[model samples]
Target chain A: MNMHTPLMSASPLVLSVEGLAKHFEMHHLNRTLFAFENVGFELREGEFILLKGENGAGKSTLLRTLYRSYLPRAGHAFYHTREGIIDLALAADVDIALLRRREIGFVTQFLQARPRVAAEELVAEPLRLAGTSYAQAIEEARRWLAAFGVKPELWAAYPSTFSGGEQQKVNLARALILPQRLLFLDEPTASLDRNARHALVSRLAELKAAGVAMIGVFHHPDDVADLIDREISLEVKTIADGENNVAE
Target chain B: MTPASSMNAALERQPPRLMLADPILTMTGIEKSFGDVRALRGVDVTVYPGEVLGIVGESGSGKSTLLRMMNLEDMPDRGEYHLALPGQEDLNLFTLDRFSRRMLRARHIGIVYQNPHLGLRMNNTSSGNVAERLLMAGERSFAVLRARAKESLDASEFPISRMDARPSELSGGMQQRVQLAKAIALEPALLLLDEPTTGLDVSVQALVLDTLKRLQRERRITMVIVSHDLGVIRTMADRVMVMRNGDVVEQGLADQIFQDPQHEYTQQLVHAKL
Candidate 1:
């Protein structure tokens, strides 16, 4: 077990999660599958925490739960917003939606490209949604695409036709286009080539300098070892394990 | 000088623009039934100007029924419908009589169906079909109608060489373009599409949808599209409403629906597509 003490920072706390847990009930099998339990962490502005675990250890599930893509069974993920602190696990749908619009961003492994929308537009969409003019947004998208080593000619092509690496580059460009206060990245570099991976790391470095809080899972921990403030390793809990393990 | 601070500054400098402007169409508590079957339950929708709102669901989801109500092709059993077109901001669609409704639809609304035969006259030339819509909008003078018809056909990317060909003579893709030319000829404020590219070849579907997207952007026409094809909805809509068994399961910005669907039914639909 590799555990490091949390880094002391002066920056404001962005997220503080406690006793978070999630489980899925399989109706047909009459089984309760516990994805993860007793997961907790704290992240401050500009801090990067790397999530580590073996396969089926629920790292992705924990990230999704923090992002509110999956509902949690217990505990609180208290996020600090300009309005005030709110429990993400219990936040209203509309409230979560508002946060997603301006403060939160998540990048998964696969690119779910909309049919007929080009790569450039896909990258520019977040900025456009936030009210940037078409000209400016497209210009910014091109800049990001070029930096990520996507060929200029392919910028206008649909990402569905691209290779896995190429599509992941487009995905990264789109997700990182907008400056988010808190970002969740799940295996973002898994499909990236070395050049694109370097570009992504540099971009992430910039985000950290600007005080953007982030929690991410990476296949190669050494690539981001220098940037990580700490690591949170999740242990898999099997069905054979008793459910009454919570502290009284 | 950190990238994060710069990024935050850049975001701050952006002008605050509201995602939705004044709604061009608003329907409240819309209900409809066919004999013993309830096609639609109490539902409401508000469509903003210059935005594409997509309605999606499986067959018999009442998506088509709700769309028909918007186009005035079918009357809802109970609902309050309002149009915010110029000089008619306060117009209530239900209050209008049949003839008045027809005239209103002709002047302000355009619809494109999945089957070109439903929207086009197979006997008429492509230009003639387009001109017919212009003629109904009360335009006179053969010279003006002829020029406008050609312009609209060109806007839809219909081949100038096929301008005089009947719909039956054209390929399926070309026929769909002709229908598009006819629907958009009147420059209607609101355009409603029912599975606009459902039957075309994949390549042809892309072309047709591209033409529609260009026209929409150039003209800034508000659009309401109903399609069982999730890809079509994902491509064109700024907002999406998911329907299931006569109820709205979820509705939100397109990204929200596709990326982080909250409703169980919506998640199933999205996952099935993936």
Candidate 2:
């Protein structure tokens, strides 16, 4: 067993999980698939944990589950919120929403681009939702976009028309623009170039210094080795193994 | 001061929570049916002050039925509808008598329909239509009626110079603006909009949406908007309720509904929009 110790043990604990498990039941095929089981971890403020796993190891699924996008089949994820500690796995929808709006930020590999909305406006949306005036949000969005190496001319263009790399940059800028206390990054550097990756690393370093706790899956872990405090690797479960494991 | 105590003080001084504010309208266990067709089946909704709640669904989804119930245009077969206006006792809308309902609608509620023809009298001038609503709400003075009409018209971004023109003489978007002006002329606490920009050109729709957004922000009026167009709902609503076949499949903050829909039906609706 790999001992999971926080690099900054003095910092406050932000999240604690135990016996977390999730599965999918394929009704048509009479099959049950296990994504991950008995996954547990502890994270503290300003700590960055690198989620290491091979393909289909349920790394992204774990992140999404913690974000309340997917419900867990068993176990508890106790999130220490400003209001108080709550079991995120069983928290009410409204409580989860409040947490998402204020504390948690998730960045997926693909950007679900809305048509006709400019890149800058799309990136500024989170700030606008948090009650910043439109003009100020746009100003901050422009600054972030420039920092991410998005050209000035493309800032006003629709992200749906942008290339994959461009879209990822915009997505990164949008999610990173706001200083969320906890962040979940699902292969955020998957499609970026060398320069763009460097920009993202520096931005993340700044966030770490500001005490933002994060869990991320990087395609190439070497790019962020300096930022990583610990690692949790998932063991991929095969179909044959899942067939014997009944979903509880 | 100790660091922990100072942090606690900072948390104490945090801004008042918006979500904790008292709701302006609450509908519980709402049910509606038309003969053999069940248009709504046990839905509950709550609207906070100054927030825009968007109801989105395909045709026959009961979204329109729910919006109509808010304005008392269509009564629900069973439900508890309560309105809490400032400086007034909480009123149970379902129990109000006919006369009281009419008075309540005229004084405190405003509705803008999909078709401008349904909302505006063709013969009345734009400002006249607005003044007529004000008059119904007991504003008798000619000067006050005209002033209120013009003020609301200007707020809706309808040209003051064109306030005298009839609805027929105005463009589709302008006519919708006139209806908006008329609806808001009384400065009602609740505004119900049913597809307020459905048939206009995209550019015109944008103009009307911008006007509505500004009006809601400037006046802080609580609004419930029903639209089949996801784009319109996305632009206008702070929160969204997704319905299908007389059942509310999902309700959440707009960003969540649009970005991470949970239910399968909601996922389909979002993907269709995408």
Candidate 3:
């Protein structure tokens, strides 16, 4: 892990995950799979940390656990918020929701949308939830969409039918619209073309400069080589040959 | 055969008076209170798989409170709340900690409220509201979650064309549909509906009830419905229990209760509905 000095004076701790572990039991098959074990990390403000792993190595699993999508079997993810430090792993639903709206954000590989919701409203949802005026939220959503090279004609169109790359742009636009203290990006650039990838990198650069902390997974290291301050690799646990195993 | 012999034979085939084919929930001596107000007192309820059990009473009669306790929304002051999910051992819900109870509820129990605002997120898109339940169950794939959301919305008869609209943007009936879609998306073993159709227009209420009945039969989901409207109970429930002053005054098969109420309170309720 790289412990680099911050560009700003006295940068605060943004997040820390301690002894994070997750395991799944397939009851029908009567076998257990250890996704990740004993993983620990700390992130300071404005640092971009890259997660590296091969398939089934639990890179995505770790990200999902930290984001509250999957409950970790063991661990504490402490996030520093305006209200003080909170363990996201144990945070109540309402508390997690408030933190998601104001302090944290996630941009995944694909965008999920209702069939009839237009792209503009989808991207503007976060801002509106944070008490932004409807008009201003729309204005900012359009600005980010334009920056990501989404066509104006598609602004009012539903993103569900958009091409993969187009949908990804809208996802990024929505996640980036708010100035989150910490962000998680899972393969965020996989569907983007060359130009769009570069645009995303530049936008990430701006966020890093603004003291945003990020933990990300990218298909290609070069896509975010300049921004990554540290790298962590996960290993996929496999059973030894001819070992007897049972989930219970 | 003589007439008395034939009647005895039919009685043997009838379902048990206080039991069911399979019991999903069995509670005993349940009691709850909010300071001075006794919400529930010494209540016992048994819910069967694929059966709609109606709990009818006026407000403060503990009908809604009983449903809330069963789903773990609020803990009873004292009592046993046991649940028997398919393929799983019987679980005493109150014995577990709050977090474990919450997790279990998310996976096996779903609850809908009378007011749309209580059950639906007013600002979230209908799809978002529906997908949130799946996300709570540890679903990580956005595609799969969204697809499940659409399926539940379709099952609830919500318009596919307006899936993206927020609750505020939809009509009251449409908003209730979104709430139903969200609850059913969990495929919960026990569905708790608290006055699900109370606030809607009579026509809209009928539409919502139709969708609910269709889904109930298609999914074979066990349900406990609490309603002040006796008509709603008559239309949806297979078994009926009447509550007064936080106690069950009468309980029986829906047909029997409708045709012949045994208690004065139940008689008054039946008369009022008529």
- The best candidate in terms of DockQ: 1
Per model, kept true contacts as a fraction are: 0.05, 0.03, 0.00
Candidate 1 shows a clash count of 2
How well does chain B match by TM-score in each candidate?
0.91, 0.91, 0.91
B1-274 per-residue lDDT for model 1 (tens digits): 2323322332232123223256689999988888988888998887877778899999999998898888898898998889887787787798789999999888888999888888899999999999998998899999999899999889989998889999999999998888888888888878999998998999999888888877765576889999999999988887789998887767766765786554557767888898
lDDT of each: 0.82, 0.83, 0.80
Q: DockQ for every model, please.
A: 0.07, 0.07, 0.01
Candidate number of the best TM-score: 2
Candidate 1 vs 2: which has more TM-score: 2
lDDT of 3 by residue, B1-274 (tens): 2323322332232232221145678899999888998888899998776778999999899998899888898888899888886555466788889899889888888888889998888999999999989999999898998899999999999989899999999988998899888988988989999999988999898888877876774566889999999988888887788898898876655754675454556656776678
lDDT of 2 by residue, A1-248 (tens): 23336447888989999999876544334455678999999888999999988788889888987886655667888888776787777665545566776789998768977656789988998788788999999999999999999999999999989999999999999999889889998989887988889989999999999999999898898899889988999987766644444321
| TM-score for each of the candidates | 0.75, 0.77, 0.53
Residue B130 lDDT in candidate 2: 96
Off by over 4 Å in 3: A1-3, A6-9, A240-248, B1-274
The candidates, ranked best first by lDDT, are 2, 1, 3
Candidate 1: which docking quality band? incorrect
- Which runs of model 1 end up more than 4 angstroms from their true locations? A1-33, A36-45, A65-103, A114-139, A152-158, A230-248, B1-26, B46-54, B83-92, B123-157, B160-165, B181-190, B210-223, B230-244, B249-274
- TM-score-based ranking: 2, 1, 3
